[model samples]
Target chain A: MTQLSIDQIQAGDELPTLSVDVTPTTVVLGALASRDWRPMHHDKDFAVNRNGTRDIFLNTPNQAAWFERYVTDWTGATGRLGKMQFRMRDSVFPGDTMVIRGKVTNVSTDDSGCAWADLDLAMTVNDKITTSCKARVAVPSGSGDNPWKRRGSDWQPNGPGNSNAKANGS
Target chain B: MIEIPNEVGDWIGQPRYEEDTEFDVERGYIHTTCSSVENGNPLFWDDKVANELTDGPIAPPTMLSVWFRPHHWAPGRKKQAQPLQIHFDLKEKLGLPEAIMTDNTMTFGEPVRPGDRLKTRQILRSVSEPKTTKLGQGRFWEIEVEYTNQRGEMVGIESYTGFGYRRGA
Candidate 1:
């Protein structure tokens, strides 16, 4: 896997678009893997009749996993996620094509010397956004710097220069 | 018109439930999750590659809650564990027939690895006033879950918001 160095990232960088044909299996497997046994996520009859939805839909944790995969795929194996948050406006159902896209909002090294990148991502199905995300990830400063190796005071997820700080400030 | 019971307010800002995962973080579960998402990040698959960063192959940060989810059935256990008790409580208390999650935020801490047991504490943060929306009439509520490893180190936190409402009041 090609690791993304912090220097190569910019405030306006666009990640490669990811589109997938969401099927029933896609929704069910994701729910199962996340250990979400909620009937709304796997039982179509329950979702449609009981939950008042069209069909079974992706669970919250499942959507979170997709967001993590999308961000990590771009940052590569070494990238470490500090924080991820999203708002779900609608449900993702089977047979809809889900598209995920992201843009870098900022890049900077923190007081502890940890390189970080802030991202804005969205998940859309059939041209309508189902979820939107904001994420903070730590990327390597260079070939020799691994953000994953940072520990103790070195890895301050809520400190200055991180997304949590921005969220708090807002 | 919907009315949130006075007792609902008492649930806010309180630790609702504290429970441990049914099983430890396992490698097979991680692999299954990766396959489901089609995530090929080597850190979740290759131990050597992950050891370069942390102690060993690490579970994906998104899988924080998966470890805390209770099993569907266990021998000698008469009642099933409800990991999300607050959600159900609000539904019953408010007389809402249906519910949907509106948003979620997760802050990650220590990397979760294989063989690690995790515990979670659920806390109700806030509940909104009754409001009308395209979906229906309901109130929005937020809950937070803090996850810790066997060593008592913080692993992550999930702040989740959901709407409980009547289908067509």
Candidate 2:
């Protein structure tokens, strides 16, 4: 597994532009996995005639999950998500390609061996930003130790302690 | 005219019991067909990278948006009342006004990897009064759902915003 130290990432460092296609099947599977029963996401005619939507757009939860994935993928197991905020701008249809872009805006280290980075994120389809967000992550300071040794190492079971684990060193 | 229910707010936030969600590696791959249709990029298609990010081939980034809702695939779960339709019908019964979709946004979280079972906790976030628009009388509301995996991890949050308008003469 490849891991980058929080220190290695700079304020201007750009996270990879990950892209995914949004399709009816994508929308349906997301809704199914999410238990979202709203018809506009799945119903074409309803969106076109009733909602005046160009096409079914990606839902908010799915967008949030993607943003999380983008950060986690970069931070690996050593980083914890602290806060995230984003706005849905344009509508994304099934056939549109969704691209995620992120830039490291701030980096700091606390008394503990935790490193923090604030990121500016945007998801665009066909050159239009459909979602823009900001997220803060707490990552291990590395303490000059090998990062690969700790891949998926710090993850605790989801509970009161889980949030604590991220807050501890960061 | 539809009669307004005295306790309309009570009905809005009634929590629907969450249902079980399951996923198989193959099923997850099959689910990615939507990504292909959307002209998805190779990042999602690369098996090695996907495994690194999700521990296995995961669904497309937006796969959950369309899949989790109670539908023909999961019949037992569908037995529960549909919230959107119920609200629509109730509004008519109460002679309440119409709603519309003004705008909405979503923030992505961790990748919903393959074989992850998620449970959705639904909530009625808020209902705002009619906002004056040039075309009509528009009212809006935000419906939010927090999705948690079997591990009790907050995988994502979904919020839907809708607006309603008065009929034209």
**Each model's C-alpha lDDT?**
0.86, 0.57
- iRMS per model, in Å, is 4.6, 7.7
**C-alpha displacement of A43 in model 2, angstroms?**
5.5
* TM-score of candidate 1 against the unseen true structure: 0.94
Clashing pairs in 1: none
Q: Specify the CAPRI tier of model 2.
A: incorrect
> Given the true complex, what DockQ would model 1 score?
0.56
Top candidate on TM-score is 1
* Highest-DockQ candidate: 1
Model 1 residue runs over 4 Å out of place are: A159-170, B1-3
Interface RMSD of 1: 4.6
Tens-place lDDT per residue, model 1, B10-69, is 888888678888898999999999998899998888878888777788899999888888
* Clash count in backbone of candidate 1: 0
Report residue A150 deviation for candidate 2 (angstroms): 11
